[model samples]
Target chain A: MMTYDALSFLLKAVIRFGLYMLLCISIYMLSASLRKKSPVLIVPTFLSVLISGSMFVLYDARGQKSGLDHRAAVRWLCEKPILFTILLFAAAAVLLTYVTFREAHLRRTVPDRSSIKESIDHLPTGLCFYAENGRVMLVNHRMNQLCHIILGRDLQNAALVWDDLCGGSIQPDIMRLSTDSQPRFRLSDGTVWSFSRTQLPDMFQITAVDITQLHNLAQELEQKNIALEELYQRLKVYETDVEVLTRTRERLETKIGIHSELGQTLLATRSYLLDNNENKTIPVEAWKRSIALLRQNIVENAEQFTLQTLIQTATAFGISVEVTGQMPEQKDVEKLFLEAATEALTNAVRHADAKKLHISLTETADTYRICFQNDGKMPETQVTEGGGLGSLRRKAETAGGSMQIDCHPEYSLTISMPKGGTENI
Target chain B: MTRVLIVEDAPMDRQLLELYVKQSGQYELVPSVESAAFAEFCCRTTRVDLILMDVCTSLYANGIDAAEKIKQNFPQIKIIIITGQPECSFIERARKAGVDSFWYKTETAESILHVMERTMAGETVYPESTPPLQFGYITSDELTARELEVLREVVAGESDAAIAEKLYMSLRTVKGHIQSMRDKTGFRNRTELAVRARDCGLIIVDKETE
Candidate 1:
C-alpha cells in the first residue's frame, strides 16, 4: 500500500513540474500578446488557471493520503491557489500597462504615414503615386478632381482611368510611363493637363499643371510677330521709293541749269553778230554764214535737242559723228537720251580729244538702249566715275536702268532703260 | 602785228574769233590749238603777244589753269580769259591766276576785239561784276569764294577728306560747308547740289580733275 502511495506522490510531482513549465510558457506567451495587443492572451491565461486549479486538487488528494508533516510541507502550494491566480492577474496587468506606455511613446516618436499621404492628396496640383507592380497606389485630391472632370467619376477605379488616359492597356513590366515621354491629357472643359513622372526604385510620382492660358497667349504673340515682319518688308519698299524721288529731283534741277546756260550763250552770239554788221573789214559771206549758223543753233536748241542735234553740235566742234536708228518717241526718254548724248559729246571732244563718234539706238523686248562710242584717247586703266559719268550712273540707276562705260578699244557709254518704265523705284 | 593764239573749243566760236582778230587789222592769227596745254606749248615755241582763252576748254587743261601756267612761264605774253560761265568767283580765280584781261563771251558789253586792244595797250581789263545767272533760288554770287572752290571739288566727285586736302581745310570744315550749302539751296544731298552747280556752268574745272 505504501509503495502505491509513493508512486502516486511521484505522479503528483511530475504533474506539478509540468504545470510549472506550462505556467512559465503562459507568462511568456502573455508578454508576447501584450506587445501586439492581440486577443490570444485569453487562451494562455485560461490554460494556466485550469492547470493551477488541477494542481490544487492534486495537492488536496495527496494531503488526504499523507500525514500532517507532509501536508505542512506542501501547504504553500495548495492553500494559496486564489492568491497565485490573483498574482498572475496582477503580473498580466503590469505587462499590459508597460505595453500601453511603450505604444504611446512609439506613437509620439514616429509620424503617421497616412497623414503624409493625405497631405499629398489635398495639394492643389495633381499628384499620383504608382507602385512597382504597376498599380495606381495613391492619388491626390487634384488627381481625383482631374479624373472626375475627365471621366465623370471619382478615382476609385484609378487603374481603369489610367488605362483610358494612356489610350491602351498598361504593360505589366513598366513601373510608370517613361520620363522622356511627357504625355498630355486634354479634358472636356478645355483644360490642358501636362504630366511629368518622377521615378524611384519601388514607385514613381506624377505631377500635372494647367498650361492652357499660357499656350493661348504664346499663339497670339506668334501672330503679332508675323504681322510685324510684314510691316518691315513694306517699309523696305517705301525706302526705295524715297531714293528714286530724290534722284528725279536732281535730274530736273540739272535740266534747268542746262537750259539757262544755253539761253545765255545763244543770246550772246546773236548780239555779237548784230553788233558786227557794219564793220567794213568783215566779209559779207562770213557774216551770212555766222547768222545762218546762229539761227540754226537756236532752232535746234529750242526744239528739243535730238540725237541729230547732238551730231551737228559735235560736228560743229570739228568732231565726226555716225548715228543709227531713230530717237525714242517718249518725251522723258528723249530728254534723257539728249542729255546723255550731249554729255558724251562734251566728254569725247574735251576730255578724250576724240575725233570720231559712233552712236546706236537699239530697242529690245523690254529695254531701250543708247550706245555712244568715241574714238577717243582713254586711259589704259579703269576710270573712276567722274562728276559727268557719276551723275549719269545715278540717274540711270534711279530710273531702274543702268549705265556702263567701256574704255578698252575706245571710250563708250551704254545707257539702258526699261521700255515700259515699270520699276519699283 | 600782234600774233593771237585762240584756245576756243567750238568751231563756230573759233571762226568768230578768227574774223574778229582779222577785222582788228593789226593782229595776225597764229595756227591755233583747242586745248590750253597746247596753247602753252605754242606760246613757248612761237612768239605770241596775246592769248584769247575760253574758260571751258573741255580738256585736261582748263583755261584758267592753262592761263596760270602760261602766265607763270611767259609773263610778257598778255592773256584775255573769256567764258560763258557767269560765276563772279571765276573772275576772281582768273585774276589770282594773273590773267591780263577778263571778258564774258555772251554777256560782256565790250567786244573781244576791244578787250584784246586794251590788253595789248597794257590795261588790266576786268568786269565790275559777273553776269547774273540764276540757280535754284539764288545766283552764283550767293556762294563765297571758298564755298565756290569747295563746290567745284565736290562736283569733281572728291570725297570730303580729299576735298579738305585739296582746299587746305579740315574734314569737319568741309562737311560743315556742304551741310550749309545743302541748307541754303534746299538740296537733299551733296550729289544734287553738285550736279546742279555743274549744269549751271557756274564754275568750270578740268574733267581730268574729276
Candidate 2:
C-alpha cells in the first residue's frame, strides 16, 4: 500500500501508454496501402475507438451508480480529449489506408517510374522498320549498332541510299509487293525477311531479323547450286554436240565408202570400153557421164515405161512367129522387128494357147505401125491394183509414147507411140 | 559331082557354108551370094544340081521367094530351104516348090554336104529330131525370106532402136518392119510373136529364161 493517488496515477499512466502503443500499432498496420492486411485489423481498430468512447459515455450516464466519483471521471475524460483524438486518428488513418489500397487495386498498377523506357534496349532481332523503297525509319538498338558498324552513319530515319549491310543494294524488285508470291531478301547477317504488301499495295514491310550466319550459308549454297546447274547444262549440250558429230562422221564414212566402190566400178567399165590397145586402162570419169546417162535413162524408163531391152531379152527364148510385108529401110528394123516379134511369140507360147501368130510392120511417110495377132482371144479383166500394165504404161509414156490395151477385142493388144512419127528410112 | 548354089544374106554365113562345102569334094561350090536375086540369076544362067536357099536375105530379095521363083522357071532344079532356125510352120511348102530338102544351118556339117550329094542322087536325108511334118497345107508367102531375117533379128533380143542402128536404118523404119511382121504372123504383140516363135521352134531359145 503505497500512497493511494500515486497508485491510481500509476494505473492511468500504464493504460495511457498501452493505448498510445496500440494506436501506433494500428497506424503502422494501416499505413501499408500496397499490401493486403488481415481482416482482424479492420474490426479491432474500429472497436478500440468505439469501446473507449462508449466506456466514457456509460460512466457519465450511470452517475453515482458507477460507485465512483463519476463527475470527476467524466470531467477528466472530457477535458483531455487526447484518448478520443488518438482513437479517431488511428481509425481515420486505418480507414483512409484501406480505401486507398482498394482504389489502387482497381486502378492501373504503378511502378518505380523514375527510369521508364520507351522500348526494349537491345532488340532480340536486327529489327528495323524500313520503307517499301528501302528507306530506314526507326530501328532497334541491335539495328542501330549494325547500321553504325556497317554504314558508318547515324542515318536517323535515313532513306537507305545504300545497302552496305548486305554488301550491295538489294534489287528493288523485292519491294514491289504483289498479291502473288513475293521475293525474299536474305541479308548477309542471316536475317531473312519477305517483302509483303502493307495496308496499301504500294507500300511494303521490309523487316530485318538476326539471320546473319544463316543468310551467309544460304547465299553460299545458292552460289554452289547455280554453278552446278550451269555445269550440268554445259554437259548436256556437250553430249548432244558429240552425238551430232558422231552421226556426221558416220554419214561421211558411208558416203566415202559408196564413192570408192562406184569409182572402182566406173574405172573398170571405162578401161574395158576405151581399151583400144587391149591392156591400157582409162580414167573412170571418161565413162562416168555415159554411165550416169545410162543410169538415169534406166531408172526413168524402168520406173515410168516399158524398156526395149526386156523385149529383146524375150527374143532369146524360143518362140514361133511369121513376119510379112516389105522390108523397111530401117538400119536395125530387122533386129527390132525380130526382137519385138520374138517377145510376142514368147507371150503367146507361155500365156496363150494359140494355133498361129501373125506379125506385120509398115511404114508410111510420117507414121510407123507394128502389130501381132494371135489365135487365142484376150481375157476380159479390170484394171488390177498395182498392175504391172499400169507400170508399163508409165514406162511407155516416158519414151514419148502412149500405150493402150484392149483386153476383149478380136485384136486385143497394146498400141504404143503416137501416129505422127517420121520414118527416116 | 553335086553342083550347089548357096544363097545367104550374111557374108559370115556364106563363108561358113563355103567352108563346109569345101570338106565335100564331090560338091562343087559355084558361088555364095548375099541375095536371092543374085542367086536366081546364077541359077538361070548355070546348071545347078542343088540350090541352098537361105531363110532370109537382103531387103531387095529373099531366099524362100527366090527358091519358089526358080522352081517355077526351072522345073528340073531341086531346092533345099536352109536357115539358122526354123522361123515358121512351113507345111508342104517344099513339096509345092519342088524343094528336095530342108536343112538347118546348125545341123548341116561337112558330112551334110556329101549327104546333099547323095540326096541329089535320089536319097532322102532328114534330121534326127524334126517336128515339121504337116500333112500337106499351104503356107502362103507366109513370110518373105527377108521378113524371116528381120524376125530372126527380133528373136535375137535386139531393140528396135538398136537393131535400126545395126542395120543402118532409122527407128521408124525398124518399127515399120516390126509392124509388117506382126500383121503377117497374126500376133497381138511382140510377146506373143516371141512365144509363138519359141513354141514352133522357129528359133532356138531358153524358154524358161525368157
Candidate 3:
C-alpha cells in the first residue's frame, strides 16, 4: 500500500510538470504572434493559452476543496476525458501557430510578382517591351500615358504605335514629330521627348527620354552661329573700309607734295626776278633750275587737278574764279569742261594777266554748255590754239563735244558736250 | 647753333643731309643714325634741337611711328618727316603726329636746307597737293572717290563679288564702276588696268614693302 501511494505521487508530479510546460509554450506563441502582427497565429495561440490555464486552475481549485495537493490535482485532471480532448486541441493550435508564423516570415522576405509589376508601372521614363507579334509584354505607367496622349487609346500594341510614329501619320497639332532617322516627339506643352527602340532576344524595347533642355540649347546654338557669321561679315567690311581709307590718305599726301613744290618754285622765281643788283642775291642758275623743275612738274601733273583744285590754284596765284552756275554732274562731261577751264586759266594768267575769271555752266535736256571769261585785257590779235588749246580741243571732240574760241567778244571760250558723252570715249 | 639729328637709311641721302647741315653755319650736326628707332634714345642722352626723320628706315622701323612717340615725350623739339616713296601716307601721319614740317625727297622744289631753316624759324611747312599720278590714260584725280575704292580692291586682286561684299555695294554696281574705270582709262581689260595702277604707284596693295 505504501508503494502504490509513492507511484501515484510520482505520476502526479510528472503530469504537473507536463501541464506547466504546455502552459508556457502557449504563452510564448501568443507573445510571438503579437510581435509579428500575424492574425492567423494570434487566435490559435490565445485559445491554447486559455484552455491550458483553465484546466490547471479548475483542477487546483477542486483539489484544494477536497484537501488534496497540487500534484495530486494534476494527476486527477490527466485521468479525465475532457483533459485529453483539451490536450489534443492545444496540440492542434500549436501546429496551426507554427504553420502561420512560417508563412508570415516568407511573405516578409521575398517579393511577389504583383509587387514587382507595381514597381515597374511607376517608373519615370516611358518603357515598353513588345514581342514580334505586336503583343505588349510589359509597359510602365509613363509609357501608357504617353500612348494615350499620342494615339488617343490605351496601350495595346507597342509595335503598331512605333510603326505609326515612324510613318509620321500622327496628329501634328498634338505632337511635332521630327523627320530625322531617329524618332523624336515634341508635345504641345513644349516638352521634347526623345524616343528610341532596342531589339532584345525575342522582343523590342522602346524608351522615351525627356530632352527639352537639350533641344532648346541646340536651337539657341544655331541662332548664335548665324549671328556670329553676320558679325564676321561686318568685320570684314570694316577691314576693307580701313584699307580704302589708307589708300585715299596716301593720295592726299601726294597732292600736298605737288602743291608745296609749285609754291616754292614760284616763290624762288619771283625772288630771283625782283633782285636787280649787279651781284644778284639769287643767281641766274637758280632761276633756270627752278623754271626747269616747274616746267617738268606742270607737264607731269597738267591734267591731275580737279575742278576744285584748279580753282584753289588760281586763287593762290592771285586770280579769283567766280562761278555763275553749277558744274555738270556727269564725270566724263565734267572732266572735259575742267580741261577747258585749265587751258583758259593758263592763257588768262600768262598772256592776258587776268585778276578774276568767270565761269558759267548751263545744262539743257540733251547737251551741257560751259563758258569761260576772265576780267583781263582783251586779246589784241586773233587767238591761236597752241599745244594746250589744241590738246583740249581734241579731247573735247573725242567725247562728242565742241569747243569755240571767241576772242573778239571778251575772249570767252564755250565748250558744249552732249549728254552721255562717256559712251563715245 | 641748333643741334640737328639726321635719321635716314640711305647712306648717300644721309651724307648729303649731313653736309647741308654742316654748311648751314646756323645748325650743329648731331651724330647721325640709320634708323628712327634711336631718335628718342639720342634725345634722352644728348642735346637735340631738331630731328630730320625719314619715313622708312633700317630694321623695319617706321619714322612716322617713332616720331609720334618722340613728340609725345619731347614736344619741344622740331621734327621734319621726309620720304621719297609716293604711296606712303606719311604726310597726314606726320601732321597728325604734330611734326613741324614734311618734305618730299623726290618732288621738293626747295632745298632741304631751306625746309630746315623754315622749320627752325617756327613754320609748319606741308605740301598743298599731291603730284598727279597717271593711271593708264587718265590721272588719279579724274576717277570718282567711289571708283577709287573699287579700283583699290581690284588692284589687290579681289574678285568683283568679293569687292562688292567688302564695299557693301551690289555686284552690279561693282561691275558698273569697273566698266566705267576701264572706259575712262581706255584699258583693254581689268588685268591691264590693275597692273598699270600698281606699277605707277597709284595704289600700293602690299604692306610688306611699306
For each candidate in turn, the TM-score is 0.36, 0.25, 0.35
- How high is the lDDT of residue A375 in model 1? 80
Q: Please tell me how candidate 2 rates in CAPRI terms.
A: incorrect
What lDDT does each candidate get? Answer: 0.66, 0.51, 0.72
Ranking by lDDT: 3, 1, 2
Root-mean-square deviation (CA) per prediction: 20.7, 35.7, 27.2
Better of 2 and 3 by TM-score: 3
Model 1 scores what on Cα lDDT? 0.66
Candidate 2 chain A lDDT trough over 10 residues, lowest sum: A297-306
- Write down the RMSD of candidate 1 (Cα, Å): 20.7
Chain B TM-score (model 2 vs. true structure)? 0.59
lDDT of 3 by residue, B8-122 (tens): 7665456546655764567888777665645665565467999999876643457887788888878989999877655434566688989999887765434677888899899
Write out the backbone clash pairs for model 1: A121-A141, A350-B58
Q: Write the per-residue lDDT of candidate 3 for residues A1-425, one digit (tens) a residue.
A: 12212335556455455656767887877787787676776777777777766665655454355544446655555455554644554675566567456757866775778877887888888999999988999999998887777667787888888876676466555666584545777887888887788999999999988888999999999999999899768755854575455445544554575566556656766766787545545544444543443454222111233567556656644568888888888877776677567667766765777788899999999999999998889888888887667867887887788989897746898889999767433
Instruction: Report the alpha-carbon TM-score of model 2 versus the true structure.
Output: 0.25
Note the DockQ of each predicted structure. Answer: 0.03, 0.01, 0.03
